[model samples]
Target: MTEHVDVIVVGAGISGIGTGYHLQARCPDRTYMILEGRAAMGGTWDLFRYPGIRSDSDMHTLGFAFHPWTAAKSIADGPSIRAYVEETAREYGIDRKIRYGHHVKSAAWSTEDARWTVEATGPDGPVTLTCNFLSMCAGYYNYAKAYSPEFDGADSFAGRIVHPQFWPEDLDYSGKRVVVIGSGATAVTLVPTMAQTAAHVTMLQRSPTYIVARPGEDRVANWLRGKLPSKAAYGITRWKNVLMGMFFYRLARKKPAKVKERMIGMVRDHLGPDYDVATHFTPRYNPWDQRVCLVPDGDLFAAINAGNASIVTDTIARITPDGIRLDSGKDLPADVIVTATGLELQLMSGVAFSLDGQPIELAGRLQYKGMMFDGVPNLSSTFGYTNASWTLKADLTAIYMCRLLNTMTKRGLRQATPYNDDPTMKSESFLDFTSGYVQRAAASLPTQGERKPWKLNQNYALDVLALKFGSIDDAMRFSNPGRSKDGRSTDAGTLQTA
Candidate 1:
């Protein structure tokens, strides 16, 4: 017999855990299950194991609002992050609801039954489950593969080569020359931390990324947390961070020149006069075009100043047995190589979905409120903001979803999805910006529509104001239109024809 639940959350990351927690708390009578792809939880944290892999944002804001992160350090490492995820799940008792090793292969929506049939592979064999709703909390990036460009003679390199995503546990790099490829967040992060113990660290990048320095500790929040109650302190802290992030984002978009100058000035102040800040730190695009790498306490620059690290901006021709041959005819010798190359982001890992026996090509469909796929009845996904704390957005998504579910149950609504006449709505893309990974997988993902719910805006305050406090009718479409007369439309919000 196939099991049935009110909701089936895919992926046990922060997003999934958050959603499960909210669902359990709000609707204890409603049955829900979480399907995790891996054997354990902590999606990104468990996967990234390189040295000094930590949160780019402050832990105070990065962690959940319902559950406070009590880590001593403001910036936490990967293990700490993983522990936090696990702890949150355990503390909320959501961990017990997880069915580990159950990877959802496909899901088909039955319009007649108004339920989703989820097909998954588990330890025993193929299993099918029915759920009233299907929610994806899998995140944007694909965990299986990291992007490592094939340089000539990559395999010919004598040293042990490792990607930050799948870093070797036993491989030691003590007192050894290390070459960290790419100037993105991961490379920048690896450079300083690896320099602490390695013989020398070189951050090699073809193009530069915008790097900015921010204090790890939220000074105002720390003071407030000490002075006020925990809940009040967290509320104040969250709003403070949210407003700041929104203000800066708006400044960058509106007054780009001033923001650009300030960003450049910050880099110059940290790197000093002699350093070629323009060549390395200056980005070709606008400040939020790509994610701005956050340097806490000026640690990355400090390592560079200490003569332990060097930033090299040059094209790599190929790898040699002894070293990497640059296009400038310079050779950077390394005992170990770390490719912090970006991620390979695939939406839902190419998971197939069918609605009423028609295959759904997400790229052609619209995205509703940047959370749920249009035409994907009774489904939603948790994709956090590229800027600000991810948890802030995740928390909002959880709340909104729970509210929607509660409203549905009250009204006797069976299903809900974005109702759009134009299938080719040009405004479905959540992210308007372009990057290597995002662009490559664009065709495989859902399209962005031109209007409000279909178009994704990353503004934290705007989204929170809309998603949390706003009316549901503006963005959501609810229905129990075709149910029999005997079937009660118990919920008032559930749309019914006169």
Candidate 2:
């Protein structure tokens, strides 16, 4: 016999924890379980153990709206963030609801029964579970593997090569010359942190990336905590950061050239006039097309100024036994090479899906309000904002899902799905950004319609009005076992489940 739950939440990460909290808080009568592939809590925080791993966004916004972040530092380290997530789980008894090492292999929805029969591989062997609703909080990328591009002659390198995603526990780079390949957030973070002890560190990139410096300790948040209550302080800081982030993002989109100049000029001010800003700091693409890297207190620049770190802008020709050979004919000498390459994009945790024996092709389906896919019933996903704090969107999504569940119960609906009625609407990429991970996963991602309810605007304020307060009836039809799959009203009374 298969165990059954009101809802099955995949993945026990930040998003999953938030989902569990909301379900318990808002819909206490419902039963749910979080299935985690890994054996631990704190999803990304536990997975990544690199030297300087930290939240790119401030904790004020990264933290759930229900929980107020009381830390002094706005930019927190990996361990601290991990503890925060764990604490939240323990506080809400969500820790008891998580089943570790349960990898969900597939989810099959039955229209006749109005349930999802999920298959998984647990430690004991194959496991079966069923749920009325499926919540996907497994994140957007592959957890089992990082995106490792082929570097010519990489096998010939003598020193230990490490990827930031899967850093070794005992690997040591202290007092050794290290070369970090790539210019993304991971690389920028690793450079300064490793530079603290490493003999010398170099950040080598094929092209430049926009980077900004901010104070690690937020004075405003600290001051507010001293005067106001913790929750009050957290709320104010969260909005402040949100508005500022939006202002900068809007400015970048409206005046790309001016924003580009301003961003480059900030680097010059930090690294002095003599540093090669154009070659190392100025990217070819416009700002906001790709995410801008953030460094707290200009630590990366301080490392460069201290002669502990340096930046190189060039592509790799190949890896030699001694070091990396750039296409520009420069050989970066290194005792160890750290590949800060990005993550592999994975949709639905590579889980197979079927509807009444028919395989579900998600790629061809249209995204419904960035969470639900068209034609897929009793399923919702948590996809956070790319430009703002991830929790900002996750919190709203969790709250909205609970509200939806309550509505379904009140209306006597067994199944709800988004149905696209506008045939003439244009199709766009699901995500609005131009990041490499997104571009690589374009073929696998769902399509977004050109208008509201089908499209996803990265703006949180608009999403608040639409997702939080907007009607769930439009573009979405609710149905019960008595009604047809298209949600046609019927007098047949068989069962009611939402």
Candidate 3:
């Protein structure tokens, strides 16, 4: 017999766990289960085992709104974050509702039944389940694959080539020369970390990224933690960080040239007058065009200053047996080459979705309030912000989802679908980011409108106002409380609201 739940959450990561908490706290009567494909929880934290793996965003904001991060370090390591997520799950009893090793294959929505029939591959074999609502918190990246561009003569490299997503546990790099490719977060992290034990490390990049250094600990937060309660301190610090981040982002956007000058000057100060700041640290685009790489306490800069690591700004010519040959005719000899490339962006965790026997092409659909897709009934996917910390948006989304669920229950509605009624509403890319990963998967992502409810503001303060307090009935069509399986109304049912 197939089991049934009020809601089925896709992944048991931060988003899923947070959603679980909200459902329990706000909608105590609703039953939900989390289906995680992996053996353990902590999705990204558990998957990535690379060195110097830490959050670019501060923990105070990255941590859940309800949970307070008690750690001294604002820039937390991966293991600590994994533990924090697990601890939150255990505290709220969300871990008990998770079904491990359940890889969801596909979902079919039935308008007549007003529920989703979900199929998955479990340890035994194929398993079937049903849910009134399906919440996809499976993250935005492909876990099994990393975005690795084709490098010429890669096969003839002769040395071990490793991707950061699938770092080997036993591979030793002690006292070995390592060359890390890319200038994003992963490359910036790996360069300093590998440089510690390696004989030498070099970061190779096609273009420079905006890299900034910040202290690992927040002094104000630390002081507030001692004087105030944990929750109060956390709340204050979270808002403080949020406001500061918003201010800087607005400043960057409004005065790009001025902000760019200040940012590049900071890098120059770090590397001294002799270092080639323009070539190695200055980015072609303005700040936040892509994400700015954050190095805790200037660790990456320190590594370079100590002669432990170096940066090379050039394109790859080809891979030789000994090392990589650059376009500038420089040979970077390496014992190990780490491809700290970007991630393979995936939508709804690449699960095949269908609605009432018709396949759902997400790319062609419009995003509704950055959560639900237009014309898709009883489904919502959690996609966080590109500008700010992911959890800021994620927390608001979970809260909004609870509000939606409660509203549906109160109105005796079984189906809630977003409809884009305005034909003149122009569609735009799902994300405004110019990052390579986003651009690579642009054709596969959903679209947004040029106006409210369909447009993503990317601002946490604005998102909080829109998601937390916004009207739930705007542009949303709700129906199907007493409808038959044959697409006929069995009773008059509740009034249809849009």
Candidate 4:
């Protein structure tokens, strides 16, 4: 007999592990297994080994709600974040439920059976499993590939070129000139950290990006932790951060000029008035149009002030044998060129999805509640907030899924599908952000409807009300009770569609 479970969660990352914990606590009767493609547990944290790799968002929010982050540093490093995730899994015994090296190839949903036939490739070979529900926790990036743009003379460059996604273990850059290409988070992080031991570092960007400086440690959170319990302090700090983030986001959206001025002014304060802040730090777009890069304790600014690192605002003409030639007739010499280019965005973990042997094109479908797809049954994908800590939204999603499962069990329903009946509903891109990665993958992602339930608020407070307290029956249609693969009812009566 083939293996079967009540729920199958793909990817054992933060989302998967958190989902596992919620399932154990809220739905104890349901059997679930996590299938991880990688050998390790930590998804992004484990894969990214670049220097100074850390969470851009605060740990109090990035960390799971069930597990309080007791560390002093609000902004945590990659290794520490990975360890925190591993510890959370062990504490909840979610690790034991995980099957490593199990790469889910595809999932086929059967309406008659009211279950998903999940196919994966394990170490032993092909493995098939049946599940009542499928949860896609796999992250939004292409793990196998990073977005590496082609430079005209990249092949002629004699120096070692590296992408942050696949950082080589033994590669050394001590006392060597390094040139990091990009103005995004990865480039900002690499420039400062690499400047510590490097002879000189230059951050070459096609255009400037908004960069912010913040303290690595949270004073309020640390003080609260000392006075109150771990969980209590964490909760307070989490709300504090969430509200503050929301306020700033709203302010930015409402008054883009004011927010942009304040952000640029802060950068000017860090670098002296003598510095060319206009050319090096100013971005043409409004605040929050793209993600603003955060540097802990103003390390990137300090590096530049110390003469160890410099920022060049110019387009890359081509890659030279020993350096990069700029379009503005300037040459940046370097022994190592680090391509801190963005990630290749992926949806549904790149898994081929089908409904009753009919191919499911995610782009054509509409997103329901930011998790489930319109007309898709018994499936949910955990996609975190782009503006705030990913886990803040992810934690809520897990809780909502549990509520959904419990409701189905109570109603004697085996399938819950969100169907869009509004013919006039206008469709928009899944995400409104104009980030390079998001824009690149816009066509491949699902669309969101203009109105409620189908539209994404992206605000945690609003999402909490909608996902947690809102009616699950709003747009969802439930059917199929105790039905077999051949459509024969195994129960006393057929379930009426609701």
Candidate 5:
């Protein structure tokens, strides 16, 4: 027998857990279940187990708003983050609502019935489930595979190669020379951590990225925790971090040159006056052009100063038997190589979606409010901010989703579809980021509108004002295929034909 529910939430990650909580809190009458493809609760945190795996964003804002981040350190490791997520799940009884090893294969929305029929491979094999609304918190990247570009002679490398995404538990790198490719967050993180034990570590990059060092522990938060109550301290710290982040991002955009100089100066201070700051630290683009890389407490620089780690900016020619050969006529000898390149951006976990057996081409659809798609009924996806803490927007998304669901209940509406009829409205690529992961999949991802409501706002303040209390009915057509509890029939509106 097929199971029926008011809502079906895919993925049990941070966003998914928050989604479930908001559903239960705001719409107590609604029944919802979280279908997680993995057996674990923490999605990215659980998947990445490499050395120095930690949050690039501070925990103050990265943490859920509803929960208090009590840890002393604002920058937390993978295991600590995983434990925190599990704590939230257990506290809210969200763990029990999750169905592990349930991979959603496809979903079909029926216009006549105003319901979604979902097909998935559950732990017990093929299972069918029906729901009035589908919440996609599955994230945008593929968890099973990470992006690793092929080198000319990668197959000939005798040394061990590992991607931080699938780091092996039994693997040993102690006293070994390590080479990490890609200068993004993963490489910066791995370099210092591996340098502590590894004989030497090299961060190989095609181009430079802006890197800044920050204290792992927030002295203000610690001071507040001692002076104020737990909740009050957390709230203050969260707001402080949020406001600071907003200011920094705005300043970077308004005066990229000044911000760039300041950031470079900070890096120079970390690496000292004699260090080759221009060679390894200076980036071609302005600060905040791509996501800034954060190094906790100057550990990466300290590692470099201690002569355990080094940075090489050059193109790769091919892989030699022992190590990597660079286009700069230099070869790096190594015992292990880490491809901290990037992640394969996957939309909806590669699940197919159709409306009445007709395939839904995401690229053709309009991204409404950065959450819902134009002409898609009773369905929403959780996409967070690119500039600030991911959960800051994610938490707001949950609250807004709950608001939408509750509105549907009150108005006796079985469906809420974003309808765009303006011919003059312009469409653009989904993300404004120049990051490799985003640029690589920019063409395949969904398109956002050029104006408000449709445009995906990266500013947390604007998003808070818009999504938290914005009109849910505006630009959205609500209807009831079946008779509502209040004896109302479906409303009228025709979807714009492509």
Candidate 6:
């Protein structure tokens, strides 16, 4: 027998937890369950167990609005972050609603019934659950696949290879020559931290990434917290970082040259004048074009300067028993290899779904206000900012979703969908990116358009006003209950349609 509920939330990450919390808070009597694929509650934080894994943004902005992060350090490591998420769920009674080990395989929307039929796989057996609403919070990154570049002799390597996502706890790298691939956030983060213990750590990359150095702690906020109330201090810090992020983003987009020069200056300041800045720190593209990697206190550069770490920028020819062979004919020997070669993001985590018995191609659908999809009613995905803090956008999304739900309940509606009649519309990406992961799966996911709701503006300033203060009527199409699923229904709330 299939169980029925008011809503079904996929994944138990911050997004899923936040959504479930909001839904329950708005409609206390409504029943909802969270289906998490993993065994634990913390999603990304739990998955990545690498050394020095932490937030690029400060905790003040990265943390939830309702929950103020009281950590002394602004930049929190993975363990602290995981603890915070678990704490939030526990405090809000969200942990009780989560069904761990339950992975959603497919969902089918019935137009006749105006409900979604979801099938999931669990440890016990396959369970079927029917719900009036299906909210996807699976996140963008693919949990299973880690990008390990195919080297000609990768099979011949004698040493153990590890990805940050799947690093074993028992593995040791002390006094060993380790080479880390890629220069993104993960690689940059691992290099310095590993150099501390590892005898020698070589950070190899095909091209340089734009690096920004910021103090690990928010000085002003730290001082204010000591002098004023924690709430006021946190609020002030959150907006300060938000506005600073916005200014820099606009500067990068509008005045690219000036921002580039300033970034170069930062690199020069961190790594003395004698070091070659162009080869390692300077990126080919503009800052924020690809997400910039952040280093607290320039630790990565400091490690290189101290001769504990080295930077290699040659193409990989193959892997050997000893180490990696570069395309430039230079062989870098290592005892252990760390493949930090980016992430493979599978939007919605390959969960199959169809709307009204018709296959819903996410790319072909119009995005309603960059959060909700057109032609798909009563649902929205919480996609965070690629360039900014994830929780900043997520907090706004949760608030907006709650507002929409409350509005519907007040107006006596049951369902809502986005309506679009533009025939010339085409699929586009939400981010201005050229990453391998996004380009590879462009055909399967939701595509952004050239304008307005279709264009995903990653600006927090605009998103704040749009999501927090914008009128729901401007984007959402509201309707009253004229016909019920059983052909006999009464008006309880307003239902919006696509």
TM-score of each: 0.94, 0.96, 0.98, 0.97, 0.97, 0.94
Q: Residues 33-151, candidate 4: write the lDDT tens digits.
A: 99999999999999999999998999999999889999999999999999999999999999999999999999998876889999999999999999999999999999999999999
Per-residue lDDT value at 258 in model 5: 95
* Stretches > 4 Å off in candidate 4: 481-498
The lDDT, on a scale of 0 to 1, for candidate 3 is 0.91
The whole-model lDDT of each prediction reads 0.83, 0.89, 0.91, 0.92, 0.89, 0.83
Estimate, for each residue in 1-498, the C-alpha lDDT of model 2 and write its tens digit.
Answer: 789999999988899999999999989989999999999988889999999999899999999888989989899999999999999999989999999999999999988788999999998999999999999999988988999888888898888899989899998999999999989999989999999999999999888889999999889999999999889999999899999999999999999999999999999999999988988898999998988889999999999999999999888999999999988898999889999889998877989999878999998588888899887888998888888888889888888888889988897787888888677988988787778888888888888888878889889888888878887777877777545668764534433221
Q: State how far residue 475 of model 1 sits from its true place (Å).
A: 5.7
Report the poorest 10 consecutive residues by lDDT, candidate 5: 489-498
Local error of candidate 1 at residue 370 (angstroms): 0.8
lDDT of 6 at 331: 95
Tell me which residue pairs clash in candidate 3: none
Error of 2 at 402 (Å): 0.7
Clashes of each: 13, 0, 0, 0, 0, 14
lDDT of 5 by residue, 203-277 (tens): 999999999899999999999999999899999999999999999999999999999999999999888899888
lDDT of 1 at 362: 81
Local accuracy of candidate 6 as per-residue lDDT tens digits, 21-49:
78777678678999999999878988999
Candidate 5: stretches off by over 4 Å: 482-498
Model 3 bad stretches (over 4 Å): 481-498
Give the Å shift of residue 420 in candidate 1.
Answer: 1.7
